[model samples]
Target: MNDKTEELRDIFTDVTDGEETVTESQEDTRGSLERDERSTEERLESVVQQMRERYGFDDVSLSDDELITVAKSFYEGDSDAEIADALGVEPETVFEARMALHLVDEDDADEVDLAAIRNREEDDATLADEYDVDETQIRRYRRIAAAEDESRTANDRYRDEFDSVLADSELSERMTTDVREDGLEDATEGMETDVEF
Candidate 1:
């Protein structure tokens, strides 16, 4: 018999007498693992292809190292404080590029979330809910949620901190007054009128 056949026989012989032979399962497991590996590599390659296409880069010519360096410098500078500072570009540019190219590491987001939850504990007064996770977990989720908010700001935390949203949202004075003409008028406090009749 060939080497593979011999190895297979040996594997079968080594199986416990009480258990049925699982030769088919072994083969299936190996096949599934190989398939998963191939799929992961294909995803990475697809991301590389998209970055090359969108940014007008020649895949063979412009290496990821060069692009990452330029992007990092643009988004977060080389020095400690300078990291997030660039001459003419906002950090969002690099964030957008990294997201578009799928180059940013996913693990970082999880870590950031963990840190945020730890820092966002109650003012040493409220009790932790049993239904809720621990302080560490809550901090992590908050950090991650904040990062996601930076990308998509429809959440309450994303709303303006100092400015009154009601005041800003009201376009016309009459409109504000019509709503507030009832008890709802309290909602439009400090909304100045510039409407010309």
Candidate 2:
């Protein structure tokens, strides 16, 4: 073969070697990452279990990693709305967390329940009063009172959308909205009377 043919063959061989190297490196990276993720998930599950046992809120508990993940979302300058958007949860959840978690003296896990609840109630009362609310919500803290918090925001909508997709599009089938828009035409017909001079 001529010299040029030999040079081309050499370059092709190098390219093949580079491609194989990249593929192998990618496989190795993915394997290590999956192993680490499995371990993290197991640890997170354990933390939530412990929290449930301690708090008797078996219906409600926060994993250490999950709490940290939520905290990181806010510490990184995420508004409650933004954090709710990122975490695929309701905005009220984000606010409840931002308010309650701040009371967590992580240095002392024993103080978490007592301090967090008391502090959250105080803060909620202050916020409710500012908005001229009766502060009744501040008195009786109910979990997941959708009726009380009918104004579920965009973040909740996003989570509902995600959940709907995951449930094979059955999420909204379980929910019934108070208002149904037959169409814009019908909704505006009542207010369309002439008001001109």
Candidate 3:
């Protein structure tokens, strides 16, 4: 009995050590993964937020994660029927998401370049006709595009403001002089009075 126990213990120890080596390899691979590559769930969350804001689709009924999975599968060249069957949803739902996200062409599983459409600044009705998707989908895409544009504009404005502040040598010198002579509170008051918010 003692010999059998010792043999089992040795086997368990060997397995444990082997698992640690595999874990180390997995960690290395994990570290090598691209940080910019977002997971499907994260992508779904962003999509859901956009949809909610655009169309007030607060009760979309379907799982956002599952929708993203379907979208990814469709983008990977799977047919709507295939995704529907795999996910146990209606084929139309798959088709709708695929169209809304501009993953593929309306009648075919071929990839569509949504960026090109945005660059053209086509109207929603025109885009709906061109994409052969519903007008609602076109509207959703337009809303998302507008939101992204606003975000980009705000970012550009902030960058310009930051650059302007950094380039203002007179303001920098004044701040330095005031801070040295009048301390931080007085310097900040002077700045508030001199500089517009």
Candidate 4:
């Protein structure tokens, strides 16, 4: 061996208490990681359950499993139309379900007069006319306004928990990569050329 190699070996031996090989028991190192023992799904489900109990998802049409899907898709930054396609429901249904779960899109909130919706005694149709948007849009804005009155932002309501659980599991990166790859594949699926370059 070269002098440098010999010197590294000697140093390693000295640092490792004269042992040629450094060994550590898995148990000795495991606790330092601070990992959650639960599976990703279990962690997400626990968070969802906590939300369901805390918020009392009154009049929400989605099942428990569907709600979980909504949470996951929302955390993945999927649009309501995309989430609706995944859930095999209409976008309006998904929108209402999102509102019920306090998953208000900031853009949606920004588009409407939340204060007017909050203080007015007018019904959704009237609000829609005043806002020059559809009744569904008015209804969604009203729900967002109500959630604001309750002092909860989208993050405070549920996104933070979903973000935490997915980020911890490293699923967020994987899912995002997968979605991007799928979109790229779909975009190029039919553009192959017969001629060789």
Top candidate, metric lDDT: 4
Cα misplacement distance, residue 65 of candidate 4 (Å): 1.8
lDDT of 2 by residue, 117-197 (tens): 443535666745654555554443323232123214323442332222323222333331212343455688779577997
Error of 2 at 160 (Å): 34
Model 1 Cα shift for residue 24 (angstroms): 50
- Candidate 2's clash total is 0
State the TM-score for model 1.
0.21
Judge candidate 1 against the unseen true structure and give its global Cα lDDT, from 0 to 1: 0.41
Model 4 error, position 81 (Å): 2.0
lDDT of each: 0.41, 0.44, 0.55, 0.73
User: lDDT by residue for model 3 over 8-101, one digit each (tens)?
Assistant: 7778779898443334344334321223345435645675556546545333445767766765575456887888898898876776554444
The C-alpha stretches of model 3 lying farther than 4 A from their native spots are: 1-40, 57-61, 106-197
What TM-score would you give candidate 3 relative to the actual structure? 0.34
Task: Highest TM-score: give the candidate number.
Answer: 4
**Regions more than 4 Å wrong, model 2:** 1-50, 58-65, 98-131, 136-197
Superposed model 4: Cα runs more than 4 Å off: 1-35, 150-157, 167-197
Model 4 agreement with the true structure over 46-137: per-residue lDDT tens digits: 87677678777776778878877887787678998999999998887777667665666678688766876688999889878878899877
Ordered from best to worst TM-score, the candidate numbers read 4, 3, 2, 1
Give the Cα-based TM-score of candidate 2 against the true structure. 0.28
Write down the TM-score of every candidate.
0.21, 0.28, 0.34, 0.60
